[model samples]
Target: MNFHLKITWYPKKRKSTISRRMVTFSYQVKVNGCNILVCREAFFSVHGLQNNQGRLKNLQKYLREGRSTSPKDRRGKKGNPSRKISQEAVQTVHNFINNIPKYASHYSRSQKPNKVYFDHDMSISSLYQEHYLKYCEQKNAPQVKVSKCRDIFNQDFNIGFKLPRSDTYHVCDEFQIQIKNDQLTNSEDIIRRLKIERDLLHAKASAGQNMITQLSKLAKENPEEYLTISFDLQQTFPTPRLTSEPAFYKRKLWTYNFGIHDCVSKKGHVIVWSEDEAKCGSDEIGSCLIKFLEIQKSQANILHIISDNYRGQGQNWATVALERSLVRTGKFKAIEHWFPQVGHTRPPCGRDFGRIEKHVKNRNPTVYTTHDWVTVIKELCKNNPITVVKMKQADFIDLTPLEKNIAKKDKHDDGSQFRFSEATAFRFDEGMPSHLKVKYQYTEYEEFRTVNITKKGRAHQKNNPFQLSWKYLKPIPICDKKLKDVMSLMPYIPDVLKGYFNSLSESKEQSDENETDVIDIGYIV
Candidate 1:
């Protein structure tokens, strides 16, 4: 019997027709005992099954067959007969399959195995942008701009070739780890070693011995000569009590007068007294010249006094003393004085004063009582030695023998023109008759030799001429009472008062007025 069958083509092969239900029909006869299903949907569906879903699914199943299989599905058994493999390869496949879970589940659509891939044209900037975008989308985080990501990537991976795919993420992790570790670790050892090295360097830089050795050598080489003596005042600060005192308190202020004397020898004595009842004005620095001269009259012979340039008290004192002496003696010769180059002078005695200050601070006295201050001053003066180096005779000489000879020649004294001849001296004496016949009368030559050779010797050739002349002409002795009298006059002779006098004199001269006359007294008190 003949059977009618319908056939259909795939969508790609379908033909357009006027009737929507026009169906192509075919006859299926039993041919060669082969059975066929000839319906349109059945033929197309069956053919599609063979070449599309069935064939693709089968191939996929075959590829994943040796990968992993579900124990529940018999058709999903692992291992393939197509690929030839050694026993070892088979064992490896078996081990891999055995390690996987027996129950199978579909892979997550969101999660996929990351595959490492390289693109020669890809830049670090592009990779960073893509990574940041993916992270923001998956984590629901804020979106970072592509420019910002590119900038950040450039900062970290400047030389960007052959970098890991997740370079930025790894860098962030590494940076966080470093910060955490650094914060937790102790670095005291490094700091302590550096401090020790710095201290050692400072100690080496400041190390030295006192410079008093040079002074000591000078002193040893000379003795009993007139050495200039001067000292520096220590720790001169504003009087704290006076600074804080009220106007009423200032009215009640009284001057505090004190005297300082170097007990070893009174050569270094000075009298420090406050001026004005409030002690607010400048300090009056007493000239120790009188006291120093009383101790040794030769101290006046001191040519130059070297001292630090204290504000109201240095070379001024020397000038005042010299002026007073000149006024008394009516001498106008200039006296020599010197000051140390500013900030260069440091005598050993200064250190002793430092020690005194340390001791005063150590005592921790709240109020400076007169008795306590006096006691401290006495102790300081007693302990601190006055470092003195006496002047020598050689220190005064300046001219050489050749210079002296030149000076003598320039004085117009020719030695030969003044010479006496032997015969002339005898002949001149023979013409003289003494008492009708003098017993062994000296000839003119002998007389001339006695006058010229013995009496007319050069003055400079005498040994120690300066000292001998000073001795012969014996200067008037300066009495102790007179010297004390000079010291007592210093308080009233302030520099301000002297300056005022000078200003008055200058003004009078400018105005062409009669010289202002005032009674002048040599003494202040």
Candidate 2:
């Protein structure tokens, strides 16, 4: 039924003998041209409406003013008027995120254009707490909370935290999505294969983790008998980190850090160098391992080393050959180097690196030279200070050629093939100096594929091959453009550090003069 309602304000019928007079509003209801006299409560009950006086007053006022026919929604009409983030604050967040060193995935860069990744060690929380907070302070702007900064990041950016080849398996995620959608063309076969692959990956990762746990326990139980350590190369630290704005755009020298953490003693050791000293290759890694072993020569009879499956660093034939040479020295009765599964290769070294990075983040002093980084690493932990080994050009020994002389062919005399890529673990013992034990999986401790490492018709040498002499590398020259850039940033460097910056030798041929230096803020693997 069509209904029309009218409200009228009227004076009280009986005048009260009080100081103020009383007034009330009454509603006249009409339905189908028939009037109905009812109280406000009864009228609301009959019409299924709330007997709210404030709402009634608002409606009466709207009608009285002739502004709106009915109460307006006003729910979403009024935007958040209380809390408003300024554009300057938002721009600060954007600037910080943009300045963050981003890198394209080496394998999937073409697949994702909008997606860029930073260092795996970095997270949104750390970025907010460590870097963003500092950035806001430096900019003299109001800082946003971690949650708001994270929101801005998710809403405004398509960035991810990752390291090349160290990230989660991309195909596994794709298969999962396909399975979830039930869009697989060959459903049964594809599902079975993908499941098997995924399970294998998981198994490999878990097996590695389990091995580390067992090794740690063994080291703790028998410290003198066994020693377990894990080492990894940290992301390159750009030198001459200055607060000056121009320093951010200029090309900076790179300082490399290789960290080794003892699982039992909980001690960390970092070998530091610059690009001008030597390149971080298998030779440099082998040299660092030699230095570490030298210190632990009288500590333990057996040594267990764990590292990631990066072939260029530790998981290569050169490193294995070096281990074999070390075994020939008879210092370690047995030495084993285990490579953790890819995509899940985090070990004690990762934690060590994290602590170092966090320490660096909170460091108040400006890092000007490689020595400054060394100082930072040395001062990382007070209870168990990290030992810093500053590597010189002479410290890097060429061990790359040892692999060719030791294992000439894939097939050995015993018919066992040596595949360094497939081998997850390598073992060298003084008793079997001519043979190397290999394991395809970390769980297989009892079983091993023994391959004759000595070349055909070559007898094992009694003397240690590495003791006679070492091949030292010459200092690498800095590019002329980079040297020039460093000189330009000399104003930001302290007087004590100016000598080092001035002493940097420029290359005879500045081949990188036209090279575009993308400001990569991420710690690259």
Candidate 3:
């Protein structure tokens, strides 16, 4: 039924050349019902024994049934003879024509980008060059083959080659093939993130509705039984944040502000301390939560804390351990912590920071010192009353957890992964609070470590207790110029802040405003 014509094996193309084992398939073609013998030899480069046999089988099928009634030759004459190549390879070649080209005029000159921003220097036909082909890796490598390199340029990346600007076809079709494999891959990630974002928005909406209904019911039934708290950190503030023309020159300082919000009542507190005083860490946030709880001792017996998924601050073992400890101490009936998917950080504290910024902008004052910032913020409280807790420089709580943030993965100790993100809910009940569960979702949960009631609750790894003596503080030294600059800005400083300032002076440090000149305070305005 197939290949009635004779087949032949050519042991060598030419005597001088290395022997090329080639197989030719012979078959008959039908043109106007007349049998015509046609033969094809395996390409010299296609080496595998099985590969040649498979190629022959395909040729036999094509021969048994003609592709068309009678194909014309290049000269438009009938049944002259024609050739066929791999459809995939042909398409790749077409793409190379439309998107990227295999050959281009190579420039030998200074660093200049090609049409596709590729700066490599090489001549056209470089892919088929003898030295490059022989030195370049396995015989099957793309660079070693004309069609393979053509396919790569056609389907792999968006980069294009350079050629002289002329009437040449290569110049005109440069960068025509934009495979955009990276963009395709990135689009998938974007789509996944968008889905998660939509899901987060829906979750927040549902949670808000539930919070309203549950809080209202709890208020009516148990009146003063529940509390909801939220928290977020703002970028540090640099001093000399004063509105000054080019003429007004001044010195600047730096500091950080951490704010917590009462979600239900819309009340907020901003915490800023001197560096020698406190470092903001998981433990410090927990301590702040404890202090906030102490202040609300009479307000609610049940606490519900909600914040975005900031690994170190809200969604970690230290905070969970702290909540459990508080519950075991009979501080509340129960504590429930909820975290939304990260990057959806729209909270009261964030809004209030905007308000504070607006207030500062409207005031249009020169913030030459930390006190100046405090005064501006304190003044902000007059019209926009937020409890501005000006923590004494020495009042920083040193007990931030030394442990790393946990990975939000849906896998076990055995190493297999599930199809979901990390836990979103953590709950502590009055009884067995220390052994509470951290839930990935409502349907999944993991148990926490239990602490003995007689012992103080402590975090694993390097944890210094909340209240360490200031004598233990390791000071980094700043230069005399920096010390003089600081003193020039504010003549009188509180003793604790002064010590912290001295430490900064020793280090010759600057905050992340990344500015050298204080008068560049044009942005502060």
Report the number of the highest-TM-score candidate.
2
RMSD of model 3 against the true structure: 23.2
Task: Give the range of the ten consecutive residues with the poorest summed lDDT in model 2.
Answer: 514-523
**Model 2: per-residue Cα lDDT at residue 250:** 94
lDDT tens digits, residue span 1-525, model 2: 656676665656775556354555576678789876667776666555774556776886775565647866675455665456778889999999988766544334336646878888899999988899899888898778889999999999999987644554555556556655557755888878777886777667777877988898999999989989999898899888888999888988889999899998888888998887777778788888878766656468898999887877888778877778777777678999888875554588878888888887787558888888888887877887888889877767777556655864576456866676878888888889768887888875558778886777656455453553454433455766777888899777778777776667433233234344212222244
* Candidate 1 per-residue C-alpha lDDT over 4-94 given as tens digits, one digit per residue, 9 for 90 to 100: 3322222233465554543333323333465565544454454455355454344334434443432344343557754333455333323
Off by over 4 Å in 3: 1-223, 244-252, 381-384, 398-421, 442-525
Q: By the TM-score metric, which is better: model 2 or model 3?
A: 2
Residue-by-residue lDDT tens digits, candidate 3, 118-202: 3245433563463335533433333325765555555754455543332122312322222234554557666565556544544
Top model number, lDDT: 2
lDDT: the better of candidates 2 and 3: 2
Which pairs of residues collide in candidate 1?
425-444, 425-445
Q: Indicate the TM-score of model 3.
A: 0.47
lDDT of 1: 0.32
TM-score of each: 0.26, 0.65, 0.47
Query: Regarding TM-score, does 1 or 3 come out ahead?
Result: 3
Q: Give residue 206's error in model 2 in angstroms.
A: 0.5
